[model samples]
Target: MSATVAAILVLAVGTYAFRLVGPVLHGRVELPARLQELLAAGAVVLLVALLATGALTEGGAFAGWARPVGVLVGGVLAWRRAPFLVVVLGAAATTAGLRAVGVA
Candidate 1:
């Protein structure tokens, strides 16, 4: 398998193994509420971090001005209940305009 696939499999299997271990080791599954809360919070944190990592980065740097402007254009168009094509056009238009004007 490719390194990326192997890494993904390892991570997935390791996570499942650890999660399953809790129940297997302790037949009486009675964890405190706080621990559960922390785990849930950690999951949310991980999700947010993953999203931010993609939405807030580009080409080895932060997402920078043009990308956010494109996203905002798309969002505004979407907020106005524009169609999918219009929203995509809005983002494309915004990105093209910004780049033409050297906003990046």
Candidate 2:
């Protein structure tokens, strides 16, 4: 196999093994309540960090005000429990409108 294919196979197997480890060890390892709560909070923080990074940067630089404002509109709709379609469309429209007016 080509080097790239071999590397992909190795990564796929490694990912599967890591996934299997969780199910295999489930119920066998008991985590402390505080640790569990911290883990949950960590997951939320990680997601928010990812969202911010994606929204605020492009090519290692600022993505411009348009993208972040679009994200904010979507976030507000989501927080208000808007439907998924409305959230996505609202963000897209906000970004497109701003770009149309040369905000970026």
Which structure among the candidates has the greatest TM-score? 2
- lDDT value for model 2: 0.99
- Total clashes, candidate 2? 0
Give lDDT per model, in order: 0.85, 0.99
Give the per-residue lDDT digits (tens) of candidate 2, residues 1-104: 89999999999999999999999999999999999999999999999999999999999999999999999999999999999999999999999999999999
Q: Model 1 scores what on Cα lDDT?
A: 0.85
Expressed as tens digits, the lDDT of each residue in 21-53 for candidate 1 is 987889577779999899999999998687567
Regions of model 2 farther than 4 Å from truth: 1-13
- What range of 10 consecutive residues in model 1 has the weakest lDDT sum? 47-56
In angstroms, give how far residue 78 of model 2 lies from its true place: 0.4
